[model samples]
Structure formats: structure tokens, C-alpha cells
Target: METAIKVENLCKSYGSINAVSNVNISVDRGKVYGLLGANGAGKTTTIECILGTKNFDSGTVLILGMNPQKERKVLFERVGVQFQESHYQEKITVAELCNVTQSLYKNPLDYTELLKQFGLFDKLKSPVNELSGGQKQRMFIVLALIPNPEVVFLDELTTGLDSRARRDVWKCLSNLKAKGLTILLTSHFMDEVEALCDKICILKKGTPIFYGTVGEAISCSPFEKFEDAYLWYTDEEGSENESV
Candidate 1:
């Protein structure tokens, strides 16, 4: 498959602490790639640098064969992003929010279609603050899809969602993958990563512990459980150092 995004020796830091260190990874076109890591392991920092939202101390980053730093606007046109948190003004109606996002794109997805897909068509008149947690999450995802981007970045997409809502998000993502959108997702949920990613990258302490197919990674372990394999790969053999 052709490459959609590439990073070489990427590094990011805050003050004296390094967030991402010498990280090299690549995402292929029309594939779903998962970035799995423990909290504060630099997954978010790496993505921020790749998307040109944060500057890296060193290394090169490219998206769609264009340098993100040099072609930020052009790159953004083809990329959709859903942040780790959902934050909207309390008074903004769902429809109004969607309409405003649609205006930012030269060619946006039909707002009504998106609302229907997210099951928010009936909640269009409700203010964002009035929606339940699941409904709010659905709204955020609809916003992400409105741009109809070639590449989508979902940061901790299922965090804090109830099981039912999480499953809904997964279904929506599967549909997006079927449509051939390149996806780069960061999640702590091992099962979620395995269920959705075609390929996976495991990060620990600002570095890649492993990068390969989930099946291959699992096969490397003597244990039958994929979660056990993950634990082994991360060097958590009944060690106290292991923490999610």
C-alpha cells in the first residue's frame, strides 16, 4: 500500500522532560493503524507533532507526501481530527455546530446525513450541554466526519464512554475504514485496538516497543490471550513497574 503518513526520528519535549523520543512510524493509505501506549507514554505528543499542532525538537514529518509544517493548510484540508476531549459552548445547538464546521471545508459531507449516521438527527434542536455523555460523543464524531477527509485522527476515541456508546463508535469507525479512509487512532484499550486496527504500534516511554500486525504480535507470545501478549511485549511479567 502507498504511504499516507511518515515520521522519522520524531522528538518532542516539554521543558526538560521528553515526550516523544526518536520515534519512527508510518501509516499506509486506506489502512487503520493503532497507536497503543500507557498514559504519558508520548502517543498524544507524537500525534500532535505529526498533525503540525505541536513543533518537534527534531526529525521529519510528512502527510500525503507534503511537509506538514510547510503545507499546514493544504494538509489540513485532507485531514479530519477528533480531539481527546469534547468541548463546546453550552448554548450551541447540535445543528448550529455542524453547520459552522461544514463552512470550514470546501466540500463537506451533508450535515443531515452525518447526524442520521450518528443517531443525532432527533437531537438536532438540543443544545450541546443538554445531551447525555453518549450523545455528546456522537456529536463530536459527526463533526469529525463532516469534513469527509482522507485521513482521520481519533485520539482516545472511546475514552470515558459507556459500553454501548463505545460499541457505536467502533461501528462507525468500521464503516469509515470500509470507505477506505486512512485512520490513525490512539487508545489504551487493547481489545479496541485489536478489533479495529489492521496494524498496531506499541509505545512505551517515548519509544516504540513493537510495531507489527496484532496477529503477529500475539503469536510471538506463548500465552493464548492477546492481552497477555501485550503484557509480555511491554515487559510486564508480574512486575510492579507495569501500569496502564
Candidate 2:
């Protein structure tokens, strides 16, 4: 399979603190790659470096055969990103926002069809601020897809959503995967990763402790559940120290 994103020996620091150290990742085309980690584990830093939103102290990053740093303008046109926290003007309605966003892209998806598929057609005229948490998230997904990007990046996608809403968003994402879109996502929710990700990278203190399929990760750990497996991987030392 062709590689969609690659990072080699990526390093970044904050004065004395190393945010990302010698991190490496490879995302294949037409697959969903999950970046999983506890708080302060450098997941965000690694992603920012790959997207060229932040400068790494040392390393190389390539996105779709082009250097993101040098070809950002061209790269961005083919990539879609939804940050952990996205805020739109409170006064703008869903339809209006879609219209504005579509204007920015050369070849955009049908705004109406996208909204309908996400079950947001009825709320098209509703103000962004008035929408519920789930509605807001669905709207964000629509915006990300409007550009018809080949690679989509979603950070903490289901952060504030309820169980039902989270599942709804999962279905939407699964649909995208079915269409053979390459997706890179970061999330604290292990279940979300287990459900959506074809390949997983588990980060610990800026280092990848585990990189493989979800089943492989779980089988390697003593725990049966993904959450416990993740906790074990990230907190093994802490757990050992506490036991001692």
C-alpha cells in the first residue's frame, strides 16, 4: 500500500522539556490510523509536526509524497482537518457556513447531500450556537468533508458527546472509511479507536510503546479490554512503582 503520511526520527522540544522525541509513524493510504495516548503524551505535538503546524527540532515529515512544510498551500487543498476545539461564529447557520466553506475549495462536495447524510438537513437554518453538542460535531464533520479531501485529520472527535452521539459520529466516520478515504485521528477514547482504527499507535512520554492492529495490542497485554491494555501500556512504570 502507498504511504499517505510518514514521520521519521521526529523530535521537538520546549526548552528543557521534550515534547516529541524520535517519534516515527507511517499511515497507509485508504486507512484510518489512530494516535492514542494519555494527556501530555505528545500526540498533539506529533500531529502538529506532521501537518507542518509546528516546527520540529529534528526530523522529516512527508504527506502524500510532498513535504508539508514546503508544500503547505498545495498540501492543505488535499487534506481536511478538524481540531479538538472548533468554534464557528454563533450567528452563522449550518447552510450559510457550508456555503462559505464550499466557496474556498476548487471542487467541493454537495453541501445539501452532505448535510442530509449526517441527518442535519432539518437544522440547516439553525444557528451554530443553538445546536446541541452532537449537532455541532456533525456539522464540523460536514465541513471537513466539503473540501473533498483525500486525507482527513480529526482530533478528539467525540470529546464532549454522549454515548449515542458518539456512536452516531462513529457511523459517519465508518462511512468515510468505506469510501476509501485516508483518515488520521487522535482520541482519548479507547473504544473509539478500537472501533474505527485499522492501525493504532500508542504513545508514552513522546515515544511509541506499541504500534499494531487493535487485536494485536490487546493480545499482547494482560488485560482483555482495550482501555485496560492502554492503561497498562502507558502506566506500566507508574503501576509498578506504586506496587513496590
Candidate 3:
């Protein structure tokens, strides 16, 4: 299988503090890969380094067989990203935002169709800041899909949604994966991880303690359930010095 993203010996630091250690991850084409970690475990830092949004102290990063930093303009055409925290003009209507995003792509998908699929069609005329939290999230997702990208980086895509809405988003993303889109996401919800992730890398203090399928993770830990195994893997008191 082709690799959509690769990171090797990735390291990042802030002065004397190590924000991320030598983390390595590879995402195959058409797979859903999750980066799991508790708060301050460097999940976001690793992703930022991989995406070329932040510089690293050492390592190699590649996306779609190209160097992200060297071919950023070309990479932008093929990669979609939805940040954990997004900001825009307070009065920018959803429709306007959608139009602007689609304009950046060479052959964009229909933003309206994407919006309708996410149940955000009626809010096109509403200002982004005025929409509810879930609506804003759906809108960001819609914008990400507008690029018709081959790979997507979603930072906590389902964070603010109710169960029904989160499941709806999952269904949509699963469909995208079926059509051969590679997704890399960070999430805290175990159900969300189990439902969408094909493989996961659980990080502890910026180092990966587990990297494999959910079943393998369950077998590695003392728990039979994926959620329990995940908790076991991430708990600081359990495996602070362990790496797998």
C-alpha cells in the first residue's frame, strides 16, 4: 500500500523542554490513522511538525511522497486540514467562507453538496461566529472537503458535537475513507476512535507507547476492551517509562 504520510525520528523542543521526542508514524493511503494521547502528551506538536506548520529540531517528514516544506504550494492542492481552533472574520457568512475556500482549489467539490451532507445547508447565510459550536465544526469540515483532497489532517474533528451529530460526522468520514481518502486525526473519544480509526499510535510524553490495530492494543494491555486498553496505555502512572 502506498503511504500518504511519513515521519521518522521527529523531534521538537521549546528551549530546554522537549515538546516531542523521536516519534515515527506512517499513514497508508485510504486508511484512518489516529494519534492518541492525553493532554500535554505532544499529539498536537507531532502533527504540527509533520504538517510543516511548525519547525522541528530534527527529523524527516513527507506527505504524498513530497517534502512538505519544499513543495508546500503543491502539497496544499492535495492536502486538506481542519485545525482544532479556527478563527475567521466574525461577520463572514458561511456561504462566503465556503466560496472563498473552494476558489483556492483547481477542481473543488460542490460546497453546497458537502454542506447539505453535513446538515449545514440552511446556515449558509449565517455568520460563522453566530453559528452554534457544532455548526461551526460542520462548516469547517465542509470547507476541508471542498478541496477534494486525497489526504486530510483533522484536529479533533468531532470535539463539540452531540452523540448523534458526532456519529453523523463519522458516517460521512467513513464514506470518504471508502472512496480512498486518507485521514489523520487527534481525538479523545474512545468510541470515535474505535469507530473510525484503522490504526492508532498512542503517545506518552511525546513518545509512542503503542502503534498498531485496536485489537493488538487490547491484547497488549491488561484490558479486553479497546477503551480500557487505551486508558491503560495513556495513564501516566501505568507506562510512563515504557515505549512500544
**Is 1 or 3 the stronger prediction by TM-score?**
3
In model 1, how large is the Cα lDDT of residue 44?
87
Clash list (residue pairs), candidate 3: none
lDDT per model vs. reference: 0.85, 0.87, 0.91
Expressed as tens digits, the lDDT of each residue in 1-244 for candidate 1 is 7899898999887899988888887989888999887888888888989988898999998889999879988888888888877877779999899889999989889989988877889999999989887788778878888889889888887777788778878898898889889999998788888889989888877888888999989888787777888878766454446543
Instruction: For residues 160-186, write the lDDT of model 3, one tens digit per residue.
Output: 999999989999999999999999999
After TM-score superposition, the amount by which residue 29's alpha carbon in candidate 3 deviates from its true location, in angstroms, is 0.6
Q: Which is better, 1 or 3, measured by lDDT? A: 3
TM per prediction:
0.91, 0.92, 0.96
Residue 193 C-alpha lDDT in model 2 = 93
Q: Which pairs clash in model 1?
A: none
